[model samples]
Target: MGQLPTDVPWDVNWDKKFESQLEELKQSGSFDTYRKKTIRIIRNPIREGSYKSENLKGLKTAHVSGNYQDIICFELTPGVNHQSQQEKLEEVYLHFIDHWDNYDSALSSRNAAGRTVEFTIEMPYLEEGYDVERAKNTVYKAVKDLDGSRITQEWGDECLRLTGEVSPEDKDVVKTAIPTTVDVKFNENTLF
Candidate 1:
């Protein structure tokens, strides 16, 4: 699980591109609106919608702004050992900002590097004599072996829930790596 800080101030990394876009916004006639939106994002960036904020489909990146025309793109960096709730995760990297006219191209370029694929799999139903810890260990080991993957596990009423991200190209490998007996289901829309 990813943990977000409740009282701690989040650190923001202004990329070169974002910095320049911000300057342009500052000089524009709509500077006040853009500035307020940027401040709101810096103060609490995880909120989505209404302000044209959304998590980019199939990726760990997101964007938010006062209007559709001027958008700020950012990437989330989950903290180590944080509890698994996605909303609670901390750390944001502001990497890009551009007009709606150039949004698609900017998104495409960033995704070309690598897209994040999120998955949810249920642990297999264990027999009475089977060791639950060992079963979990197997799943954890499989995910750990992946090149770029992070997962959070939770025990539910009837099954164990595993959710996390991995490189798009490694999706198939991850599926095969899970224990054969485990019954898993992937969220189709989340697969890159």
Candidate 2:
């Protein structure tokens, strides 16, 4: 488990994939009320509408605003050792933001197009003092060894995202390439 900083306002950040989705929402003008509401989620996490996610332990989801069509998924870390009496979290990591209706579809992508499938490896951003440099070096080394694979890591505020394509044969290689300490997720439909 990783600990979060005790900084005020709880540093909030998102990954590239989430940013891409957010950009689409911004362009379509659907996120007008989302920005302010997100601040609320970061400031106060255990509010009425927010719910502890069943599948993703330690994470939660809450609507951006009242009856809003957008949803925000984030992980909130509490202050160290319950030293403070207040209920404020030390950090808020934005995992994703999407139209409420697209969740079902987002979880339903077809089999990953092996030989050309793009992979994104995500690892939570831990508080400083963690071996971040060594971890990065390990990933870089593995990426270098990948033959014909074009994987790149894009670090995010919430999670480190490594996005790139791998061939069918190299797909399995990817599984072994990244360390088991890293957490990787694909659409629900993806088997590998």
* Clash list (residue pairs), candidate 1: 1-83, 1-84, 2-83, 2-84, 4-88
lDDT of 1 at 90: 46
Strongest candidate by TM-score:
1
N/CA/C clash count, model 2: 1
lDDT tens per residue, model 2, 1-192? 122233523343433454446546556675555453433333233432343333222232343211122334333353422325335544433323344444334322212122234567776677454455566666666666664355567778887777665544555666765666775543221211
For every candidate, C-alpha RMSD to the true structure in Å = 16.1, 17.2
Off by over 4 Å in 2: 1-114, 127-130, 186-192
Question: In terms of TM-score, how similar is model 1 to the real structure?
Answer: 0.41
Q: Report the lDDT of model 2 for residue 111.
A: 21
**lDDT measured at residue 27 in model 2 versus the true structure, 0 to 100:** 65
Q: Per model, how many backbone clashes are there?
A: 5, 1
Measured on C-alpha atoms, candidate 2 has an lDDT of 0.44
* Candidate 1: tens digits of C-alpha lDDT, residues 113-178: 234566777764554544566767766777776754677889888777787766667677667756
